[model samples]
Target: MSRKRVAEPGPLSEHVPGRKKACWGILTSQGSWADRSPLHEAASQGRLLALRTLLAQGYHTNIVTIDHVSPLHEACLSGHVACVRALINAGANVNAATIDGATPLYNCCASGSAACMELLLQNGAHTHTTHAHFPSALHEACKRGYSQCVESLLSHGADPDYGVAHLGSALYMSCLHRHTECSRILLHSGAKVNVGRDSDSPLHAAVRQDSADQASVLLDYGADVYLRDSNNQRAVELAPPGGKTHQLLLTFEVAPRTLCQLCRLHIRTVIGPSRLKQLPVLPLPSLLTHYLEYT
Candidate 1:
């Protein structure tokens, strides 16, 4: 996928006339990016009553600071759903980004605010980033081990394999940070097991973190143990010798697949990650569906 800069935002001229063009490296529209206001204070502090009063008094919902962070950003980051709802209802830009390229959706992920995530997505917040460099919303969720946010973003079309040059893939971040559930969710969602920053795979991340369980999960999902990083070191090379993770990877290298394990892996691969959600609804017997859900 092209990493082109997001398109320049249109102006918010109708909201306020004296403002300059929208900027977060360029354009969104006529909203005022003035110094912080009472509205910002109210939103960030979770003062819903104060926020409602300000909005009732005509505080522009899109008013931002010099960096272009709107009140919606503040509310979402703090997990203040009432404030978030109020701001969005008052016309806050659901997709407004900071100069650093943070959208309210990104903030919701960063804060692990799944409730705020639902509200924003319902308000039409863009899940896929328009910018090339900033971590996508999905990355933020996985990095923080926010499994609920990760699941929601995936359900909303967040790319499971979206990667940044420095952050690696979302799966890499999850395992490197020792987020077991997040890593499992990413793998089950069909994120490429071997995709990582440069040549490092998620298996490399799991081993580096000394997470035996994570490494085992990656192996189950077909992570390539022999994959090398920039240093030409395999995942086992990063492990402390004879440690649990090193031992686990070593075990995976030598163990023949159990027939049941092979069958499950084959079924998942054939069903494809994108289609895994269909398992519950398929006409398969309950016993089969229950077994499939184990992974």
Candidate 2:
């Protein structure tokens, strides 16, 4: 988006003696006319003086773009700590979400801006709010391996088990983004290592994400090796072809048990077809819950 640059002058011109209006000349030069907010432009360009001036003159800190991206989102993206602080002090809603439901904290953390993240969190930002448009800030932090920021959000009650639009959980995101250390932290902090959401298990995420370290961590934390994704692919099948990570899964085996074909097939449908063959045969009993646990 483009914004009009107002000439540098004091706000609100007062009437002087009558003067003739100057005739305007259209420049055939390179530029085209633009339409956007002065405040938004200033914030986006990190023009601290203009931003501060606007804020001081009572320009709205809560101004947003057509897409509902906030000034805070711009400030965080521009790495303008001073502008961010000024906007927050000017009573900007620190937790304000964009049109996509991404909060300022989510933007800050996603951009790897630890200082901005701390400021947002200290100023009462919502670490637990999930974005229907995408993953939460904890997921962003974990995905990016922003360990310090991750710790900060976790301290402020960010849920390790939080799920979002495509990402299953913080653990899932960490795996997907290949942030091995962050995955380890979340798992140690009580993230469900074996759970799936939106039909994606951590094993599925790890293999698809090409994260050997994260996959190992998940296995150590009891990730189900035989778990499957929506595509009917096992974790082993998801692994990159010809690698130690692939070999590791090939070596790990679950003990065998006999199960009814219908129940087993139903479980396979829930999990995936590729995993069905790996499952041990189960015994016949009035099936209440057909799932089995190696532990």
Which structure among the candidates has the greatest lDDT?
Answer: 1
Q: Supply the TM-score for candidate 1.
A: 0.86
Q: Count the backbone clashes (under 3 Å) in each candidate.
A: 7, 7
Candidate 2 lDDT over residue span 63-96, tens digit each: 6654666677788766678888888988889877
Error of 1 at 136 (Å): 1.3
Which residue pairs overlap in candidate 1's backbone?
9-27, 10-28, 11-29, 11-30, 12-29, 12-30, 13-30
Report lDDT (Cα) of residue 157, candidate 2: 71
Query: 114-190 in candidate 1: lDDT tens per residue?
Result: 99999989879888787778658888888889999999988887788888877989999998899999988888787
Residue 130 in model 1: lDDT? 70
True-structure RMSD, every candidate:
6.9, 11.5
Which parts of model 1 are misplaced by more than 4 Å? 1-32
